[model samples]
Target chain A: MQRPVPRRSGGGLARGIPAVLSVVSAFVIWEIYVRVSGISPLMLPAPSRVLDQMVQNRVLLWDNTVPTLKATFAGFALSLTVAFGLSIILDFMPRVRRALFPIFVVSQTLPLVAIAPLVVLWFGFDLTPKVLLVALVTFFPMLVALVDGYASTDPEIEDLMRSMGATRDQIFRAARFPSAMPYFFAGLRISITYAVVAAIFAEYVGARAGLGIVILNAKNSFRPDIVLAAVVISSLLTLILFSATALLQRTVLRWRDVEGHR
Target chain B: MTALSLKDVSVTFGDIPVLDRINLHVEQGEFVSILGPSGAGKSTIFRLLTGALPLQTGTISCASPENSFAFMPQRDALMPWRRIIDNLTLGLEVQGIPRKDARAHVAPLLRDFGLADFTTHYPAQLSGGMRQRAALLRTIVQGRSIQLLDEPFGALDALTRTQMQTWFEDRWRAARWTSLLVTHDVREAVALSDRIYVLSRRPARVIAEITVPIPRPRLGRPPSAQAHDIEAHLLEILLHQTGEKP
Candidate 1:
């Protein structure tokens, strides 16, 4: 999509070519190394073999991808909404922020490996557990970014707004919120990548359909190529989510970029 | 006609007293300045006038309330994210005026302030002088009769500050709003203000109030003899307040 294009002219192709070339070169070396070294396909699949398996099982891969994508988007959306709402409440009420902030930190300290299975046991094998896992993993960064953004707002601007008869809500809307936007996007980028990983991990523990299930099935059948194929798909999904966040950041925070040039 | 008055005002932040029994007033259609050394609580007086700092012990009576006055602090304080015109109309927007109407209202005044072509430009694009001019235009467009400026030109380069001083003086002569300026610069206070009040160090109290003996249209090379005399007198008072030999 045109939306994916980098904002600067000519620089996009100049910057993108090197990165694309490096990945392609890595795959080429890997393909050649595996073939010449006489390594067993069971241990490490050759790049070409993985590509072949991917084409043969395209329908299966696509079917698995659909469920993972759905879970990730649903969980990411839930996390974003909840984080935004909580950050706003914490910004206005410092006492509440103080009381709840440590609890949020403690929540993050609980390993997902220990908690994901419990979440699955409680929610059954439905999408609920996967979604909750993603939410739990992604919410903290977004909340911290927003709270920090709101707190770091320039006091002079706030004072100007207040002197102009702006109410507390007006100051928050005009000054605090806009200043917090860049930070929010920073958090969103982090959470987005985590959301995808969390969704797959949740599925690995318990899910009827998804790339995690495909990987598990391939591993049991000793189809290393098929597992690698699913790994490639997951990697692509993470890249897409990451790039989309960068594009959104560029669009919304254009002023910051303009200021830098000047 | 006196526009505003603060009688026997005293302010303390925790146990530290900022302004002690301060008394000052500005007349209608006059430019008044408060001159003091740095950290003499000059800005605290402004904060009090704007109602940003609550009145500790004082009687501050303005012809208009705090909200009805335009206040410009030392910093330009323009919203970097907003275009020049949008930042100018922000106050109007806060007052329940529609954005379109507020933009329209400021559109004509932009030419007067030399910012007609830069309406869409962000604050970062402007020079120091241009930013201060935009800030001043933003304040003036509020249509408030009382203006409280706290060292508005203190951030600019010396050349820019001088240019801004002349520019502001020309405008003030044409449209005399009841203006109160707080600055540590003696020349700035002398060049622009009709009356100047010199304040002492911490727990600031007015030590001298000198009315400019020079007549209006006080601009150009080699100021009047009276202007020179007043500047010397104020400088001496400031030196005395700071316990420095001049």
Candidate 2:
């Protein structure tokens, strides 16, 4: 007998309450720890001090954030375009897939920190190197996801299509691409976070502006509050990117329910 | 004219033969069943007919071109992402049939197949029986002259399978398309087929060809003694082929 599937309600507060409380609790603990320990504000500032630093330097924070955001978005767009094109090429040609798959695996092994300085020097600390670094880090996951998705398509379905007189291009458009979507979304979610981190790391090596530069300068000047504020902003950026990807996934794959449960 | 002809057809994977020197002729609009136990290479016959696997030896000929043949697999092969209407029109779409025209063609079929209400629902949202119906709808909309079904209803329960068999008979009689079904169920083959071909185990060879004398829509009504006698005879033949004593 088929069990009844439960209808989901889009109750925002029901889902948000727990997450909001967790953040609140963490802040409360941080406030208590700083006050009770009597730690110097320079070494470990209170959450309030971080908030004050954010408000006072809001203009500076915004100015630095724009460059990092620009690099991350540019890199992400370039990576997606190249990765998607490469996946299509590889999917059609098995020999190319076999030849390039090993190269992709080896490329991931190159150390980011060691390569970042050379990239900065080569590109002269401009937006180009930071974008390239981010693209390098983000491309592999999307490529791998697409390949696995293409491979995992059901052979039975493909055979049925062939029997129906569908050409190879038609089979791919109707069946193979749609089946690979969930996997592509999963890879995108992972890569979005990595894109932001890669951009920041590149900025840390050498950048005239960006949050990473602020953090490094604050650490040298012994201003822990400014460093914490920068960290918080970066985390917020990561959260925003992740949530957007998730929303896109839900909208695109609205037809498919998550398996085995509501 | 003969719809399908297999002359000395043989299939092998490496050294082991799956089908050996099989010969048969299916008349146009006739419903035939290739009945056998598992590993009898009944499915290999369907694959060969559909050109999914290459013919190793001898001549395997279809009166129609590749596009004129439609295949239904043992399991529901519906795309989970597509709705029933879109799924049914997949064959048409792949043939470069315009989406507007395909939808128009499939609209009447949705109502005919009792799937009008569920046309917008995805395959995952459907029951097993409903999925099978949707699959048949897709196959029928392909408008092929020959349908190759490999145990299409084997996965359904006893009750659903019976209903599907009756539904299939009604559709087959109405559509008048030639069909070659591969099945292990002796009673099912005897009930639905005009003629049943029994295959021997492993390197499968045609052992017997028995004509089913029962009329269309056989089941629900009490079985006549003649139907019972024919069923017993077919069963005995199958048992002997599998080396079982009656």
Please report the candidate that would top lDDT against the real structure: 1
Task: Give interface RMSD, per candidate.
Answer: 8.0, 2.3
Q: Per-residue CA lDDT of candidate 1, range B1-246, in tens?
A: 788999999989889988999999988998999999999999999887777998989899887764658889789999988888999998898889999999989988787788998888778778889899999988888888798898999999898888888888888887787899999998888888888899999889898888886776676667888788888888888787788542
Tell me how candidate 1 scores on lDDT: 0.88
DockQ scores of all models, one per candidate: 0.48, 0.60
The parts of candidate 2 lying over 4 Å away from their true place are: A1-5, A9-12, A258-262, B244-246
Whole-model lDDT values for every prediction = 0.88, 0.86
DockQ of 1: 0.48
Candidate 1 error regions (>4 Å): A1-10, B244-246
Predicted candidate 1 versus true structure: per-residue lDDT over A1-262, tens digit per residue: 0112123456667978989999999999999999899999999889999999999999999999999999999998998899999998998999999999999999999999999999999999989999899999999999999999998899999888888889999999999999998889889888888988898899999899999899989989999999999999999999999999998888888777666631
RMSD, one per candidate, in order: 3.5, 2.1
